[model samples]
Target: MKLKNQHIEEFLQSGLLDRYVIGDTSDTENTMVEDMINQHSEVQLAYDKLQEELFLYANTNAITPPDYLKEQVLNKVTPRKELEPEYSKHENWLSIAAVIVALLALSGLGYLYQQNTGLKQEIVETTTQFENLERDYELNDTQKRILEMRLAFIEAGDTEKYLMRGYIEEEPLRVIAYYNQPAGKAQIEIAALPELEKGLDYQLWADVDGEMVSLAVLNDLKPKTISAEILKKASDLNITIEKAGGSKHASVENLVSSIPLNTIP
Candidate 1:
């Protein structure tokens, strides 16, 4: 009973309404027709108009055609020749033009796709090159820092020294002290240093005459010269391995090297 636009068009074209209007219907059929009419106002209107036209044609009995007139009409009706469908020259040309246009469009799209792919690859390569350059720059910066630290150590003037006694399972201590007098700075550069355990750091101490002074903390054992201002006048130097950042007093037992400034040039 429910119909869409397509269903309505199909029913109209099939002439089903003419058959239904002329037939006697049961209660179920009457109910179905009523439901359809209620659901679609357009369908109800079309059905009413068709019924009116059929009723008028069926009831008009006085204006009948004569037998001779009917015969003459039947004689005048002739069979029509079927037309054979053929494509024109212009139609053939148009079809070829359409195919050519489609092929050109597809070729253009493919070219654009390849160009885009190439551009993306180029961008990726360029980005990788930039990353490599950045890594190189970082390495160079680290090297520059190390060189600057070395230069600062060599330029120190004020000097101090302390004695670091060796502990059990470790070798005897040996280290030299150098100070920059003008800058009131001191550095403890170690030689013949022992290998340090992991997570431990070497700490320098300045022995000013007899008093002990913390100088610098060192993690690298690459013959580095640590530079820092002397807190007091000193006479001896000491080098001890302790926890990172060093301690208030030397982990005396972990001493790696110790020497007096009087022995150095």
Candidate 2:
């Protein structure tokens, strides 16, 4: 007997692709048909691809048909005409139930399709963010290494240095220095300092001749170098402890350290 399209579809749904290809002969004629299919290269390729898709579908766990699919299939296959005429009254009711089941199956399939599409889009977006973060991390590491090299060069020479001293709430006396060079730019390195009290800050200054210029503010002086723009005209550098934001003019009594440009090599 020739195999019908419905038979092929049913076999596919039941996940018997391997059995169909191998031509198991215990049942007779199905074995012969399987042998023919195996011999055809075109058919074999199509079968292999179909098997891959079916395996993916099984693993995804995303496709779920409505519960009423079986009931709808049974209803359509039942021999209604062979039943007694008394059952005619019930035929309309069965037909309506079958239609409802089909509608529900269609809705379920549509919802599953939409969910699968959304998950794919989310995966793509997360991959893009990960790539961007990797690039930023590499750039930050390069900039940090360059800054360290520059600080080592400054610490090796007789850079002009100033000292600042201040007391906050009877805390231990704190001192910091301003190191300026004749090359127009300088860095401030804190050496031998007391811990700062809560809610107070230390600031650096560059006093050119008699005129003082503010340089930077230090909150937590951890052993790391910070970059500053080169000063255009400054002869002296000073440091002072100021109110949190610092003051417009250096309070004479607040002076912590003073270093002149002529003294620095």
Candidate 3:
């Protein structure tokens, strides 16, 4: 029911309306036109005008006769000598009308050709737009599903949250940890952490009992979410700036942030 001017114009320019009015279109086309006429006011108005014109033309009750009948009638009306001038005048005017009709036919063909090309181009453009929209919709749908999963994990009854405030940054920076004991999964969320300098690596470590265990390397921590495997005996978490790959043990002098995790579910 929602139609644009261009869409309506395509059908009108295709000469389908004339065919529908004269019962010349195929069954499918007739069905389409008839449906539009019922649903679309523009198509209905066009069909009505065409029907009016057809009716008026039929009701005129006068038409051009055959050439043989016209010749017989003209021959009876004039003398043989005077009729030459009349015939000459008739022939001249008839030739001009024929040329005009030919030109009109050629112009009509050209117009139809242009309309067909425009419609094809519009169809191609519309198809491309639809594909792009579908792709974007799929991408957004995937992101939405991921966010929903993260939400469910955070809201789970067996999840514990830990927030670590960094003292190294002038601006306030924080890291959030979500540990789910039942699922044995740990997720890290960095907030307001600036870009790391080249060659500097931020390594994460889990302090179990008194021994430090390597957990993950927090490289380029730019306020993004990351997941780490929770150590079975780890009681605390910490981050330290180390070499590019990471360090075997926690560098307490390079520590930026630390959090105790004894209350995790």
Candidate 3 lDDT over residue span 1-265, tens digit each: 3457778888888998886665456667866887778877989999889777755644453344457755655554344464588555544433433333444455566668889999999999999999999999999999899889888988898878888777556766577788776786778777656456677777778887788787677764543443445454677888888887888877899888888876433
Instruction: Give the residue spans of candidate 3 off by over 4 A.
Output: 1-115, 208-212, 219-229, 243-250, 263-265
Which residue pairs in candidate 2 collide? 163-256, 163-257, 164-256, 164-257, 165-256, 207-236, 208-235
Report the backbone clash tally of model 3: 0
| lDDT scores of the candidates, listed in order | 0.58, 0.56, 0.71
For model 2, where is the 10-residue window of minimal lDDT? Answer: 223-232
Which one is best on TM-score?
3
TM-scores of the candidates in the order shown: 0.43, 0.48, 0.51
lDDT of 1 by residue, 1-265 (tens): 5548777777556655554454334446545655666677766887789667754643442234457755644443322234232323323333333333344455566668779999999999999999999999999999999779766656544333433455425654455554555565555555545556777777887776676677777655455444444433555567677887788877767655566655332
- The residue-by-residue lDDT of candidate 2 on 56-150, one tens digit each, is 54345333455686566566646577777644433443444344345445656767777889898999899998888888888888878977865
How does candidate 3 fare on TM-score? 0.51
Candidates ranked, most accurate by TM-score first: 3, 2, 1
Candidate 2 achieves a global lDDT of 0.56
Model 2, which residues run further than 4 Å from truth?
A: 1-90, 145-149, 152-183, 189-200, 220-236, 259-265
